[model samples]
Target: MNINDLPAEMLIEIFTYLPEWDFLRNARHVCQIWKLISTSPILRQNVELSKYMDSYAYPLKYFSAIQLYIKKLVMHSTYIQTFEKHHQDVKFENLKSLHITSKVQCTWWPNSVFNNFFSMFPNVQIIKITPEFWRDAENCLYALSQFSIIELDFGYYGSNSFGTMGKLHDLHYRFIQFVQCQRSLKILKIRASDHFAEDTVAQILEKCPTLTSLNISGAYVSAESFKISTNALALTEFYMKSQSEFKDGDLEALTKRAPCLKTLNIEGCRSITERGFRHIALNCSHLKKLFIGELDSNCVTDVGSDVITKIAKACPHLEFLSAIGCSKLEDDCIIDLTSSCGSLRGINLNGCTNITDVSFFALADHCPLLNVCEVRNSAISLKCAMYLIQHCKGLTKLNMSNCNNIDDKNDSELENMLETQSRNNKPRTNSSVNSKLDMSSFSMHCFHSHLKDLDLSESMHVTRTLATKLTRILPDLISLKLSISADIESDEEWFQEIFENCVCLSEFKLSTTTIQRQDYLKL
Candidate 1:
């Protein structure tokens, strides 16, 4: 059969797996059949023009081909100028979502520029503008108010300076006006320095009755400011990160109103203590993903095991939890958490040095569906690693960096097997040595094929022999990191053997103390 004899549906399905840029630049130009399949409505439903924005004239050519079929468009600032010069009258009637990103500030453009640009997409329901577009806040907000966008995500990177207090107040007033204009608003995310006042949050909750997701970061939200008159019944996801003024009282008030919240991220909110979590347990029983990591904070002593015990008991459906840098957490809390929340798939306990092997054992005993586990800089021992490998069969990604107890001795079983095989392969005399087999030529079975990403960086006991055994045990690794303490001399052949054994490996990091030779650098 000829290569082109395949059905058109099959060809289209194959082309769907290719990257958008590759389909546009290479696959579409192959033949008329391929071109027609590539430009089909299915392939052109979501178009990303940011890659071609680097060249001034390239995006205009591709835009002409897929403009009518594009339901979602993502373009950079340079494409705005290209469109204005060439295709201003082009109407994207099917476009529902539009994402605009700018490398530099868009202060030079006036409100009329955005108004005219947005007029082309008459049916756009979702608009996401990066922070650089907010440098000219008054004009941008004024232009956005003209349209009734259902979802607005003013990107998380906030302005470094909001000018004077008077200007900030004016900007806040204009922002509120913009929110009031959107009658069907459902999702809103904004990260501006002190941009949302106490009443502003209350006003949004009361006015946008259909709002379901609200993310306000880099702002000061106190209990008084976050207070609302009625319940936010439709709200399900609330994220208020890095709000230093947000205390337990504010969390209590907010969770009381937004009782249906399933995903909450209050990371870096140092003022929120165990009392805040107690409120979450009482009100938000449907919580699934919680990120309360106090990254780099020295004052997280208040969030101890009591907080985790309450959350684990209340929220049994919790799947993902991140408590990074919470130094006060111990093994008891984790044991209680994993034992209760059997549905947990990912947990980040990085920098919690007090947690010992007890937590890992608990995870292995209860959380069979665990996938991603990070315990970097912790006190976990070899038993924890062995238990996780033996019990958690579905585990994929594991980060054990700076874990001093994990050394080459963890692979003692495999080492013994290798020594036995070597003795059997040895030649009886010097004449038969020519037929002797190398260790790398042995066909070792893989113990764990599901694990794709493994990090053992800064582990002092990782020798060349142990690393070679790891390649055989986990042959399907996509990313592997090893910081071996052994010398690097005459190790080029071993590295080549690793690449040959782990055929699917794409990213590998190896570091040693001794200086590497010139030939070893090539591998």
Candidate 2:
């Protein structure tokens, strides 16, 4: 059908699928009718309109003409001066989001520049400034008191041990005071230099009473050292990472404080023990997604398994759980989880050595819809893996890195099984049905043929022969990661042959000593 013949609504639906507005420019050139439709107010308000305008312009083009039109503008050190030169015509009025990463020299200037730009944009809602622009940030915060800014992301670029200094203590105090006074800020993400003091965080939380989402990933805030004020009762999502800073009793304290939290992630918090996890489960009963990482063997042996098992029992509504590197977590805990939490959909247990392949097989047996299983650095044998491949058909992503037991020997056994199955399916009169089935080809098929993504990195025993064989077996494989494996006997020839054979493969990683990057690049 001609472009003009298609209904306008249907055309709009087609246009929605295109990520950039620039597609409309080409669409306009198609005909006069399309040009008129493309310029409509509705089309001009395309969600990704800025992306369209950006495609044709240099990083620093006529700043004034494009300034007001830009919805989300990210300014690195190079383009900061460009925007500063056209500072007046460069209206931040239409800018819904602004991210400025300036150099040390441009700090003072960017602040005054934004002070002018932001004052005109009454609709300015989200502002993110790099640490280089912190001085400018404080100025903008002070100047744009009228702005209804809802989201603020401040990167770490401060001086004088910016992470640990008490300079932010004053800013926290003022920010909280602003939160109490102002009405628009609902999401606050602050990446302090290193670690923040408890009093500083408390001050900020107390002021931002309406805050629903808070992420302090880079900031070194131990559960013991940092405390959220009671005002954080409204919070629905909280992310805290304190793996580098080891302070006792912090996890327990933090969980107890944030009772209303529905999505809690305490990744790399090594000090968090069973007591801390229990405290979290007891307090945050509403939590639907929990991420607990960096767990040591001792913690898992002591109470880590029990902590997670009990959480599964308590949080019946939990949908996603990522407890990677918790080496002590065993098969029984997983069995208990699948039995208790029927709502669980995705679980990532990478580096949980105590879990064998049976853990995955059992999880598949119990959980009807397990989609993702990442069991890297475990000792799961080939038997359980085959069981998982057969049983967990719903799985999309499977990581069996370091499971070298799944080699040619295992393939031989699977071929034997397929041979037996094929023999049983043979008919007396129609022996041709047996030939049509291609039992020899069935012997070559891997147990998991439907897998789209497979990561077998660091499996030292895996050879090029087995890798190539497996790729052919799983024809639908899209992403394959086989890093740090044993080198191919004839590297150059083997790689070229493998790449040519694996037609469906898109993302391939064969780095480390097993395969040089340059050698792989040659393919």
Candidate 3:
């Protein structure tokens, strides 16, 4: 199939995957037809001015062509000239998403600039604003309410002129009024620590019932007064962290309101108890991701896990579960979890010392889809580790760092099997199985081979010989996290073996605790 003979639609689709500048500079210059497809408004919908901030890599006329197709304008003060009103009549007809941010503060953008910016994109559906830019939020809110905004991320870093009770109330009233007006609003993220906006947030939730995801972790949420009587069935993801207000009953009530929730993270709620966990396990049966890790104390102990199995039984579709430092859990609770939630992909049981080899046996027997398993500081032994590797063939990540019983004997066998595979065939590459992988980010992409990610950091029994052997075998290793082995405390030869054999590694995290100073120099 000649490249020139390919249909225009296919060529356009291929061009969309190329980097923005590469498309304009290389692919577009291929031919006249390619240039037309490259400059299409659909392809240029997400217009970011940040790349053009540092240097004038392209001509002014090139940007003029881009201005016509630009739909989502991302502005940074560093790139202020890129968004200037040179083409005042440019109607930005397809504009939907607008974000203005500054990593380094320049002169505060006045309300006049805000008014002009809003006027330019009258059809925006997404707005990400550094709230400090708006001198008077009331007028800006009124203008935003008139637009068809469905998502808003407000990072408010202005002076607290609303510190006084009366001014704060008026500000809250305006924000709630704006929230109510946006009938199609679905995602809202607010970042302002001062002025606990519990009542205002409650009012917004009550008014904009269509909101699906709400993140207010950057703001203080008054849990004492916040109540939700009406069920927002559409709301699925909610996060409110670092708060003392979430009592046992509040989360259960919130879950009852948003029963279809898929992801819920209340990691900073200090007052949450076993009852709240039980409520979530019972009510939110559709939950796919749940995070209930606490900082101050263990919220869900053994007693909680007993009731939390209701989650495993009810939500068998659960994919990700994290309950760090919840040590009261025993083997049966984990057994119930592995037996019920067979679709579980990743689980973190760090600091859960009560669990033994029986849990691993259950995981090996039931969970075939499991990929990542972290059981740091657990009681899993070498025999059980071998059993797990034998059964769970699909596991790409297994972190047994503090499971001190995991010695070099069984892992030596893995090294042998890997050597056998490598000796029989060409070195494994990502292209071998790229179709099943997610290539959105190079780092996130899997190596597409057996045992892509491995961590044996704290397991002191990993000998220098086995380490070198495994490196030669696992040719497609994308990540290898390791600690200095007890016997091979500082072997530069062992480290060299990895670089020599594992050419495909993209991430290598090491802890050089036991390496001698001179040994480090040798490395």
TM-score each candidate: 0.84, 0.74, 0.77
Q: Kindly indicate the candidate among 2 and 3 with the higher TM-score.
A: 3
Task: Report lDDT per candidate.
Answer: 0.74, 0.62, 0.67
Misplaced by over 4 Å in model 1 are 1-34, 51-55, 131-135, 156-164, 196-198, 228-230, 296-301, 413-446, 485-490, 512-523
**Candidate 2: tens digits of C-alpha lDDT, residues 283-391:** 7788888888754322332336787888988887777888877877888888888887766778878768788766776776877566777777778766666566555
List the lowest-lDDT window of 10 residues for candidate 2: 427-436
Q: Report the lDDT tens digits of candidate 3 across residue range 399-421.
A: 77767776666664565455555
Candidate No. with top lDDT: 1
Pairs of residues clashing in candidate 1: 198-225
Q: How accurate is candidate 2 locally (lDDT)?
A: 0.62
